[model samples]
Target: MIKVLFFAKYRELLGLGQMTVELHSTTTVADLKNRLVKEGGDHWAQALLADNTLCAVNQTIAHDGDAIADGDEVAFYPPVTGG
Candidate 1:
């Protein structure tokens, strides 16, 4: 299972901080996002599909093509800005 975590605004919007999903070993970050969108419906689409949304795999920033496997931790959060 892949552990998915939502942070900041996303956590609030989704109403959950984390979840576990079963995915193939070859799944990529984009694939995982797509699955989440499908499962969570419009709410997830709005939060995850936004252009500014960012992703991390196992605590390191990652891109769409990054490979994911069992026991991996994936996190999604929006960019932060402060003065």
Candidate 2:
């Protein structure tokens, strides 16, 4: 299973900080985001916009094509803001 973490508004929408998914070797970051969008419906769709959202795999930010494997940890969040 690949562990997934959601932060900020995403966490609130999903009511979860983390989850685990079983995916095939062919799975990519883009695929995972699609799955989240499907599961979370309209609300998650907005937060998961590819251009605005960010993803990390194993604590390192990853691109859309990055391959995901079992036991990997993935996190998603929006861009941060600071004073």
Candidate 3:
């Protein structure tokens, strides 16, 4: 299973801190996002839009093509903003 974590506005929007997902070997970060949108509903789906959200896989920023594996930690958050 892959451990999925949500942070910042994304966490608040989903009302969840984390989830464990069963995935195939070929699954990618984009695929995971699609599944999260399904499990988390419109708020999460909308928040995860590519232009607005950020993702980290195994604590490193991940691209859509990045591979996912069993027990990987995938974290999601809204884009960060600061002065």
Candidate with top TM-score is: 1
Residue-wise C-alpha lDDT for candidate 1, range 5-76, written one tens digit per residue: 999999999999999998766799999999889977999998899999999999999999999989999999
Off by over 4 Å in 3: none
Q: What's each prediction's TM-score?
A: 0.93, 0.85, 0.86
For 15-44, candidate 3 gives per-residue lDDT tens digits of 888888887676988888887778767887
Point out the higher-scoring one by lDDT: 2 or 3. Answer: 2
For candidate 2, the per-residue lDDT at 48 reads 75
Candidate closest to the true structure, highest lDDT: 1
Off by over 4 Å in 2: none
lDDT of 3 at 24: 68
Better of 1 and 2 by TM-score: 1
Q: What is the lDDT of candidate 1?
A: 0.92
Name the lDDT value of residue 74 in candidate 3.
91
Q: Would you list the clashing residue pairs of candidate 1?
A: none
